[model samples]
Target: MTNIWEPIRIGRMNLPHRFAMAPLTRSRAQADGTPGELAAEYYGQRASLGLLISEGTQPSADGQGYPNTPGIYTDDHVRGWQRVTSAVHARGGHLFIQLMHAGRMGHPDNTAHGRAPVAPSAIAPGEKMFTLGGLKDAPVPRPLATEEVPATIADYRHAAARSIEAGADGVEIHGANGYLIQQFFSPNANTRTDSYGGSIENRARFGLEVVAAVVDEVGADRTGIRLSPGSRLGGIAEGEGHEAFYLHLVKELARFDLAYLHVAHGGNEELLRRIRELWPKALLVNRVNRPLEAATADVEAGLADVAPVGRWALSNPDFIERFRRGAALNPPDPQTFYGSGAAGYTDYPHLEASAASA
Candidate 1:
């Protein structure tokens, strides 16, 4: 039997297979940051995957940077997400909500309160994010004061608790993709002199604190963190010789005994082997274009405990069985990705072998 199809334990849950769905932002939520009506059907369609990580959701109003992205801070957001979890569980899928704060990667026209973005330092991301008006330059976010830093971290803790309350199995802290936590990790973005800056340890403080807080709210066994060690997205540049930075970060994070440490842009065999040695927990590996062959290879090589696929899962409702049988997949229409209706959301075709029969 292929180990790819074997059962494995992640935290208290035993997954029937090693394939998981990575979080992908579709920006299809309500304008007020509430989960839209189609979300339950969208997620429920792909519930054949063992695990599904939802899109990056803001923990607070200030944390939001993209239009139509969901939030977990408000009562409405929690109730909206409950529908998704219930729908997924009905099909025997485990779900985790990824808490993402976009930091300085925001424009005023995108947020409801129209507030300036916040970050580890008062730096601009040297790029633009989509706003209601149009694409515009990202503003220089206000530097978080030392006294107020704890509150920012607490926001993540509150969101984690809310996720479990919403019936999610766990939470994944979004410490990647040039977001709030990743902003601090990048020297190009974090220029603070306080304890949360300067050395690698200091720069990693905010991320560690956020993770610790979430772990406290949810148990360590039910928590996870995602990182993209080499990704320079949104003008985020980690300083030279920062391989040591992630090495140290992963080693320290290993002490928490979390369920998993997910890595984006960590797919190379050598790099994966090195990090796998340091992380004592399950390694959920994902990066763009993680093909079925590569995923099978990594799992067989023991470099990854699970391979999380994102966009492919977006278009194919029966992704698991299709991959298992080496069948063709449905191509996603880019135009309908963020649209209001179900044109490309829930109407995608599933295999005839699937229960839905497309």
Candidate 2:
């Protein structure tokens, strides 16, 4: 049995333990798409998590979907992230910045681009998004012209370079969560008749190309990707052939010899087993809505190399210490989960604070 505390190597970096801080969106960035000043403190406080994956960062202005989410495509963005990465490194932690393009999930009101969102097709996701102006229904996105696909892929490569320049250990391409990459995986979200649509292989083309581009710009050892095989987030349906689609996608992704494959799993047992068999490198699994007991059990049973925790890590920056000590965890406040303040961001009580208060 593999104990979660044992050291493991994922790509070029070596971690002291297996409990990683999952990527989370806190909506706490500057208006110009730079990370908020408090962002450094927030992340630095959680450096004990060993491997902290930063929140989803937009690769371009068009990638902005929610208000105040950070970007990695500009000089200001790079400088802002430098503070974050430096803080994490000073405490001997590794950070992987996740690059996410919202695609149809984007709204013009939230971004300076002030244009309709883009997707594999011109379909609307029929979801409401909160913006600086107010909440609004997602607008039907503009279909990317065939020629524009290459440029879009280039954005990932550029962002990967920017993440590296900002001193991150690696980059994780956000291929999960009904984002641009997952939009291409859905039959309803993507109806293109070109090379980017019609078949599973074609639909996988854009994401794989984006991954390849990022790998070329930043070595494979410094690149990773997250995928949700059966996620229905953002109203996405993976179609009848989803199982086959994911199997093929996993097999294709294994060729890169990348850092690790992060799976935001939602109870797709057989497919996950297949992925485990096919994937050759590190596998980080985040079981949606599962408790720490279950997560650790998965690692103990050889199900995943690492278990990334979201809210637990959020509400308890000293989560690793508490877990090691078998102490209590601070309950996460849903109200402050997406707000821009220190109330729930970095103000969570650690074991020492809790004991002192008692």
Candidate 3:
């Protein structure tokens, strides 16, 4: 039977195990959107996770939603990530940089741009966002002009090219978690009458355009996309008739023949089953908040090609080793989870250290 311990083939990359590290925002980047100095060390420490997916990296300045989140749009950003990719490669692990564009879930005070966020429509997420000034209500975003939507899609291509230049094994477009792509998918967040909104096909256009652009810049084998169906995050409402739209979106995305399809599961088992049937390639499933013992339940059931974990892998750098040894995992500290320093970032005890202390 397939399990997390087994090997898996994702796109052009052949991972030794089915253990993938899900993207977790560490918010430790420099003010200029470059990765922190310790970024390499932190990712390298967890290279044992097989596939290390980096945090939400903005494809453009306007794409940033939070302070100190890394960007992959600039040459400096490429250089900053090179160290991280090299570190992971040296440890025999592959790194996929996640390209995220936060739509209406931003405070101008949070991003260096100081401009209102952009989305398919000028709607607000109705959530308080952390910013440079402090916590503030998310502001209504500026609607992307019909003509400007293509340029926004191009931004993803540019970032994907830059990610490849940085020696990253691949790039995962952040289409999930109520980000730009998902914003376009949500009826509440995107109520535009343009060709980029309204109908499911039109709403799925922006996401497909961005994905196609990335696949064109970088090979399909080097591209992946994360999606969260029926996710109410960022005050998004997929609408009561949402299941059909999600299935249609997945069917359309499969035509690209891109890399894996990573789903941030939102308790829709039937929908996930449908998605698994529709997708022909790798399918990564993150059972949100599921315990360690059930991490690979989807994999064992042949529903997921990989089992991606967040907190478990975060607190235990030697995640696979500890699992093999049945060693107790160090509890993750909520305080340092999103900090600038290396307190809980890189200070998590490895299996050997824990064994020594014991």
Best by lDDT, which number? Answer: 2
Between candidates 1 and 2, the TM-score winner: 2
Local accuracy of candidate 1 as per-residue lDDT tens digits, 78-131: 999999999999999989999999999888888879889999999898897887
Query: Against the hidden reference, what TM-scores do the models get?
Result: 0.96, 0.99, 0.99
| Cα error, candidate 3, residue 46 (Å) | 0.7
| Selected candidate, larger lDDT, 1 vs 2 | 2
Determine the C-alpha RMSD for candidate 1 after optimal superposition of all C-alphas: 1.9
Q: For candidate 2, what is the TM-score?
A: 0.99
Instruction: Judging by lDDT, tell me the better candidate of 2 and 3.
Output: 2
C-alpha RMSD in Å of predicted model 2 compared with the true structure: 0.8
lDDT per residue, candidate 3, 1-358, as tens digits? 6967888778878899888999999999999999999999999999989888999999999999988999999989999999999999999999999999998888888777689999989888889898767788998899999989888999999999999999999999999988999999888888899898899899899999999899999999999999999898888889778899989999999999988999999998999999999999999999888987787688889999998989998899998998877777888999888865999899898888877888
Ranking by lDDT: 2, 3, 1
Quick one: how many clashes does candidate 2 have?
0
lDDT: the better of candidates 1 and 3: 3
**Which 10-residue window of candidate 3 scores lowest in summed lDDT?**
104-113
For 39-120, candidate 2 gives per-residue lDDT tens digits of 9989999998889999999998888888889999999999999999999999989999999999999888888768998899
- Please give the lDDT score for candidate 2: 0.92
